[model samples]
Target: MNVPAAPHSVQPVRLRISYRSPESLLQAFTKSVGKGGVSLPSQRPLARGTRFLFELTAEAVAHPVEVLGEVVDVRRSASGEYFLNIKYVPGRSRKGLDAALLKLFEAHRHEKSRRYPRVPVHLKAQGTTQVWSVRDLSRGGAGVELETGELPKDARLGVPVLLELQLDTGRLMLHGAAVWLTGGTSRPKTPPALGVEFGRLGLETLRALDRVLVLDGFPAGPWQAELTFGMDAVGRMP
Candidate 1:
């Protein structure tokens, strides 16, 4: 007797994938995706049953969709690329993620809004103090410019550090972890930068950030606090 195949739960989609873990955030592409599972081409394939979080960004989509997936199968492409099959795992987090994706779809139908209100400010980290330009501020995270060797050689993903910001309202203290770093190439000829996601934001501080984000007609989407970074070895911070 022959056995029947499992049913497909969700429609298949092809999306650009940004895999985030404590080690670093790397880019990849999906071959096929559905509510039940997804197939992606990856340079670093994980062992079967390994679970991780990633953001699916698409050209037509305004914001990336966050999903927690577990590796179920692995395959090799004709071009010698590794293809990993990932099954979606739903829990308390799935509901919020679904809602956020829906909101992004709605916002995409409207006029494009400003990225976020940013201003020049001097801030210090480590024992040495220096001025850094900050932007894309949210209750969850912000981006900071990093010149050559600006990031501590010892700094790694998910390492918490205290940062001081000089907002127009007043001075504020923030605790965040290094999530993503990019740049330092000939094309740009500019310094690289680090992406910091807030970990211990106070109630008052959140309100202050909300004013800066929502007041200017920026539609809120998923933030980094809901995800975890995994450790993957990468080159030095740029």
Candidate 2:
């Protein structure tokens, strides 16, 4: 006879997420709705009926969208990843939330599809003792602006460098290699910029980067595809 699995214990959780823009918030909320409910990664499975308090905010919104939810399902993957499905409680703000979601959906319904290999961004990053401006970013690399005078004398293609980005959540340190440079003798007409391709990133670092990308309206499908490819490449490395 097969033994029954043990029941998960109840654990209350509270989470807060702030989006950079209203459009980003709409994307995330709609995606979650399509998945049946909000899904959050967890280290351990929570029992069904576990309560959750979520505070969602966006830069344009004056007030947070507070919602209470209960865990309706728990799932664990073969890779030991745990996730909880949270069903929202129909509170006083339910109608307003529904209306807002509908408005956002309608507004974007007619928008044309576009591809984003890199998204423009204004972010600060520190390398060694100098600060650089992050002008654009993609899953694989970043374009940073730095004056020719500021560029290190030893800076060249394939030179490894460490950059600490000031993300909204916190600072993220990344290892990268300079792939190209412009605005020097090679390309005098172009603005001074460095193309740095990131090295192998840890899971946490990838997740953090994902959060930033999502807020910047990066398409989820492409991001997921790239992430899977990266993971597969890492797995293949001896």
Candidate 3:
């Protein structure tokens, strides 16, 4: 959920999230939205960068009036429930998330509700000539399975790549740059995953990212999992 426009512009909020995924789904419960903070208990441990879709009540709504927020903290309790602390968008989303939300109400402008299910899809990355596969996809970016080979780490990250995504309903093609790479054959090892940011995104894709990042919950994955944090997408993580 992108932050709604608001008058009192603040800084971008860095929200931590506990998201339900195509795999692990979290049951809903109630807790405090703001004022002080919030927490959750877990029988099992939740990964850092775990994402969740939060439903906000009227009181939880800040100036933006949108209840959506991101989880910042995930702690394990002896009792077992995972504890979560979320910072709202005005503080995190666009950084200026607060100011933008108010703008909506002031303009009497109604933005269409943008929502796209995070359908776990595959992206095949073909370089300006090389070949890769999308481990998964979200709007802002994608997680891709890289070609196995020996290349300088810098070269791998700097490469411009194209992604061909096969959606449940259709196919979407896009381009992005690898900001970071993960997974080395060993530890202090390179993690078996890489972080990618979108080099180019269509309007629908951008909107899709907003909804998935803000509201959708990412459950655990079957493969080696790395909790995708922020907006970067990288998968098949070891």
Question: Against the hidden reference, what TM-scores do the models get?
Answer: 0.35, 0.40, 0.31
Give candidate 2 misplaced runs (Cα > 4 Å): 1-116, 147-150, 216-238
Q: What are the per-residue Cα lDDT tens digits for candidate 2 across 1-238?
A: 1112335445346577787865565555534432334777776777788777566677646556556677888889888878777786544244434444444445555656522245445554444445466666656787787644446555667776555544445556566778887776666766667787888989988887766554322232112111111223234332
Error (Å) of candidate 2 at residue 12 is 37
Please write out the lDDT profile of model 3 over residues 47-80, one tens digit for every residue: 4444333432222223221334445666666665
Error of 2 at 109 (Å): 18
Instruction: Find the candidate with the highest lDDT and give its number.
Output: 2
Compared with the true structure, model 3 gives a TM-score of 0.31
> Model 2, poorest ten-residue lDDT window?
220-229
Give residue 187's error in model 1 in angstroms: 8.7
Q: Which candidate comes out best when scored by TM-score?
A: 2
Q: Clash number for model 3?
A: 49
lDDT of 1 by residue, 1-238 (tens): 1111222334222333543421111112111222246666776555776665556644444455555666688788888777777776653133433333344335545635634333222222322334344534556677666544454453456665445543446545666688877665633665667777777677897776665443221122111111112221112111
